[model samples]
Target chain A: MSKAIITRNLTKRFGDFIATNAITFDVEQGEIFGFLGANGAGKTTAMRMLCGLLKPSSGEATVAGFNIFTQTEQVKRRIGYMSQKFSLYEDLTVKENIRFYGGIYGLSHQQIKSKTEELLGKLQLQQEAGQLVSSLPLGWKQKLSFSIAVLHNPSIVFLDEPTGGVDPITRRQFWDLIYEAADRGVTIFVTTHYMDEAEYCNRISIMVDGKIKALDTPAKLKEQYQAASMNDVFLQLARAKPGENNSSS
Target chain B: MQPIVIENVHKRFGDVKALHDISFSVEQGELFGLIGPDGAGKSTLFRILATLLLADQGSAFVNGLHVVKDYKAIRRQVGYMPGRFSLYQDLTIEENLNFFATIFKTSVEENYDLIKDIYEQIAPFKGRPAGKLSGGMKQKLALCCALVHKPAVLFLDEPTTGVDPVSRKEFWEMLQRLRQKGIPILVSTPYMDEAMLCDRVALIQKGEIMQINTPGNIVKSYGKKIWAMRADNMFRLIRDLRAFEGTDSCFAFGEYLHVTLHVPVEKVQAYLTPLQHGNLVIKPAQPGIEDAFMQLMQEQNETV
Candidate 1:
């Protein structure tokens, strides 16, 4: 499989502080990669750099085979990004939000109209298409936001804590949607605080302080760490003292 | 009287019913958790108990003081930490704690013993502005400020919502210490796993309390045989299990799909074996707090 993301010594520095310290990894095409880390562990900094929202201070990286430095726009175009804080407009109707994102992605009017209809049908939101996004339940709103994120069919999608504060069943339903997208060959690079969700990833990278401390399939990481669950594995890796096992692959 | 008593309290915002006849009580020195997802009225109930908002109907008591009639007395006796970080952004950590202490007609020195353990963790950053601290540090400072006055009871709303697992564990440990210190704590969280750490948890959803019991009792009383099933294609497995006639409910839980059956496990295995699922594994699984919560929510949804 072709590589969806590649980085060699990716580093981002904020003045004297090194927020992301020369991290290196690759995500394969259609792979569901979980980026795990504690708060202020440079997960966001690394994600921002890969998403082309922030410039790296040093090293090399490419997303969707495009250089993050010189081909930033190309990288951004080939990736769909959704964050819990900001995704859809509450005031806009479901269909309107779809049109807005579709237009922003430079889709033609004909394409946007067809995609909106198709999305509404698949999500069974044909009835809700005319209603304001705010009127829908939290689960429906999140699913709608995700559908709109991928309406333009980008090769890769980045989800930042997409299931935060959602109910259990709905959280699983959201994962089902993610699985469907991944089945269609859309690479998923996601970050989450929920460890159970981390288990759904094909592979995971746990960041501590500014480096990738552990990166592997969750089963292998569990075996290596002698953990029964992903939560235990996360606590062990995140609580490890700095300079303890600097690298694990 | 219980340290905290909520009797059929009801709260609504315009057309939306935020809390519907919510009633629960916390014994002295108990660490009680209100477990639910966002928009489940946990914060509304907390605000009513904190005397920050009035209930539309029914009543609540904190330390035997009426929430509505004795709002002033309740305010002085209860330490409330709202879900959002509400400390003075421009003030240093020490300043915030001192400010809270002063408002309660007490000084940090007067109740220093009450907050010593938690405060020491953040004391090194006492000079830092409240807004400058990291998420975990801010949480610690907030706990210290909440404890500085040494109120009769404590109300923490979603104290560990967005915090990482390590920090969340530490925060819960702090709560456990506080419980041992003989203060009743009414904390709320969206995470179901945290419910097990509490003395008892009230499973809430959509403006109503579904059940209130010890987390262990809640799981034991799930009243269904749950099975853990997994295959090479988990997504398809969930769909197939949900489509099965004998399946009552199926949900993705970590590495396996936790399923409740109407028939037998042998039947489920027999049904799925023909589907060409690679490396399928099926075994009886214990129901957890989340599983119980989901079951209750489903039953509630069906009834409504």
Candidate 2:
């Protein structure tokens, strides 16, 4: 029930283009939180800040109890991130890639071995462990990327549109892993353009034109806004654009 | 022979094997959907069938023409809309449509009836550059160009990704209308809900076919009671319910968490007491296509 993420009036500005307007929200420990938005909606910007990759133009935030601005290194050590692209060296075998990433994260050789085996086994990747990362199929790569992201047993993980262009069946598999991790008390923060995926989150926040206009469980937000689905909620806020009312009760 | 037949096909790019032993056929006039994510090999399969790329090992046919041997003939009968908006950015919408039609040895006037419905939606912006139109408008134009020749088979890769909801719905509606013409359409999408709209779907993962069935049969195969529930402390509710011994699998579904209870619903009491006096709600429900996919994945992992 503890807050794993907290942001207070977070803001990001790039040459007067308010990439992320003043926003406030919190994510509880072990919760699967979906960050929903249209393209260019600043979902990426906000996630970058939380991942310790970018600094907020203003405001304050904490991830895993580490100050986002000053203790980013500490925060980085406690979290894992998977980008939209299942980024792994295409030439490296799955096992090598895991070792390299785990090594960079300072995992001990023995620790990396045990974790790799466990992950590979759980993901049904034992048969493909020796295959080059690029040789593996897209669905395999996606699952591998997620496993690598959380390989070090980070307290929280961030996924940036991890299911952007994969099949529904693969996305479903990805979510099952996410759920499995969440069941083990790992907090998950992900951004996705897929409204259906948003429904899988314990709570969701919709960003439009650099501002968060809706935040709640998908149902409450839908009911509160008199919308039917996440898609409707998105359009209702997105079409309102920059000058319209942007907050919900 | 089917309109489109892919037999034990495989494709690779450098070290990346995009498709592996994928085999399926599209019946003439059927709406076939390839449902998968960005890298599920949807594009690779589409390109192979469109004769833009060749499979490494297997054979495929469009209108019973070999994709490799009859590439030229296949090209004339298939229209492909890539995932990205790839029309000439500088060409006006109307110009782009005309150009595409000309490439197929046809004219806008010749196929006006075929594309008239979609074309009308963006007609106002026809004189504007293809890049200048909104995402939805651009999508409509792409469809028009693809249909200008009225090919017997059409290929659309991730056609609705990043587009607005209304436009997504409208685009699908247009596809439905096109189905009336008896053209076998092959569309790819990462979204599960859209799978229901297709007459049949091929669910792929890691470049392999997972299942191929009509949407209705797929739903019928999922025999689980899903319940959606929520309360004031939604986060707390999600955790407590997930932890309860009898709970099978719980996921956030819209406003409530879709949960599977091993115990009877009337038995909501034994666990309801601990959750009582707390701000939460509980109820039983049904599974959507997405839910069924999750269960299948879960089952696959347990056995694998």
* Model 1 accuracy (lDDT, Cα): 0.89
Give the residue spans of candidate 1 off by over 4 A: A240-249
- TM-score of chain B in each prediction: 0.97, 0.93
Q: What is the C-alpha lDDT of each candidate?
A: 0.89, 0.82
Docking class of 1: acceptable
What's the interface RMS deviation of candidate 2?
7.2
Estimate, for each residue in A30-87, the C-alpha lDDT of model 2 and write its tens digit: 9999988765667878999998999999999999999999999999999999986667
Candidate 1 on B139-245: residue-level lDDT in tens? 88888888888889999999987788888998998899889999999999989899999999999999999999999999999999889989988888988998999
- The second chain of candidate 1 has a TM-score of 0.97
Predicted candidate 1 versus true structure: per-residue lDDT over A86-145, tens digit per residue: 679999999999999999999999999899989999899999889999888888888988
Q: What fraction of the genuine interface contacts, i.e. the true contacts, does candidate 2 reproduce?
A: 0.33
